[model samples]
Target: MGVRVIGPLDAAGLDVALAPFLNAQEPTAAPYVGALVDRGWVAPTDAGTYVLTQEGVETHAKLLERIQIQRAAVTAGLTDDDYRTLLDLLQRVSANVDAFASTLR
Candidate 1:
């Protein structure tokens, strides 16, 4: 992953924070925000905004690893099958992480 400089962000702030990298308008950003919440990267605050949790920080670190792997695969001219395999591996890993985290709660 190309190390993108990120700072604290909320749902409404994505356009500004991601301007240099992505043209993520609210239409696109909403689903991503929902997914982040769904995956435990973000929590809805009482103020009706979202904040990144400790789990979000940790999950982002893992996502960076996957980004790097995919970048390498693309650079090597790997086939779509290789990408699919990586996606499958990531899904299994996510399921395992979810299960393990559940045990602690």
Candidate 2:
């Protein structure tokens, strides 16, 4: 869970970048754009391209909370049985969601 800087992207591109970690979680992107802009984490470069600013690089580098959280969770009493069950459950739910989404497509 090393930190990676992401652009001041529009909602769609932001989703693509965050999808790996954001699965099953609803992320607030629109408001984040404004917030990030305000904080100077990102900046608009053109009509479509948004670049990760210097602030973003430092911020992400400084933040490893996600990595720490996973480390803490694994340090907890999480056995292999619990791990497998969680993975299986996630897969099953994802499969169902994918099937439903295909219908919409």
Candidate 3:
């Protein structure tokens, strides 16, 4: 999403770039745009446009790095134990989320 939204100089340009992830002509993209604003990953220009800040670029790069790492891991042959470990870790994370959510009940 950052990659799609970061390079545009204006909302129109952003709509074009974001076409793949969103319906550029609809209100469906507002949440995505709002999230970017909330995170300080993007800023509004005096011209009513948007641009990526330095932090956004840095964060995008780090996100790309993690994606590449995950892709590499998937392509690499995993031993049974490696798969088990990953599943176990994910299960633990899910359990933690459920536990935390339950507290808000």
Candidate 4:
């Protein structure tokens, strides 16, 4: 991921940015943003938003690359049919969980 990929830098924006890795709630990203600022990975702008520093961009790219590598390794022996079957099973399980959850609501 690059700075361009992240788009925004406010807490709300960060919530979206961190969603994939953290599955964080919208209000919870503030602490994560603060941590990023403290680490010099991001800088607060006069607009009260943040932007990725050069180091942040570099780090994000590295992390994304590493994830890609890991994903490839994990799926190395899986065929396309295997992937489709896995996806279908996961979707069915998710739907079942959602149905169960709705009952508790």
True-structure RMSD, every candidate: 12.7, 5.9, 9.3, 4.2
Work out candidate 4's RMSD over C-alphas. 4.2
Kindly report which residue stretches of model 3 are placed more than 4 angstroms away from their true locations once superposed: 1-6, 23-28, 76-105
Task: Give lDDT tens digits, candidate 3, residues 1-105.
Answer: 234434556766766666645531363555677799899998888888877788988997998989978867884897778878987998799778767886886
- Candidate 1 on 1-105: residue-level lDDT in tens? 356645455666775565444431234466777898898888888766677789988877898899888888674875779778888898799778767887887
lDDT of each: 0.72, 0.71, 0.74, 0.77
* Residue pairs in clash, model 3: none
Candidate 2, 1-105: lDDT as tens digits: 454545556678876776654544356455667787789987877677667688876786666666677766775787868777978899899889877986885
Residue clash pairs of candidate 1: none
- Score candidate 1 by lDDT: 0.72
Candidate numbers, best TM-score first, in rank order = 4, 3, 2, 1
Which of the two candidates, 1 or 4, achieves a greater TM-score against the reference? 4
lDDT (10s digit) by residue, model 4, range 1-105: 233465546766776666644531244677777898999998988887889899998998898899978977987899989978988998799778767886886
TM-score for each predicted model, relative to the true structure: 0.47, 0.50, 0.55, 0.62
Model 2 spans > 4 angstroms off: 1-9, 16-28, 69-105
Q: Model 4: residues >4 Å from true position, as ranges?
A: 1-4, 16-27, 79-105
Better of 1 and 2 by TM-score: 2
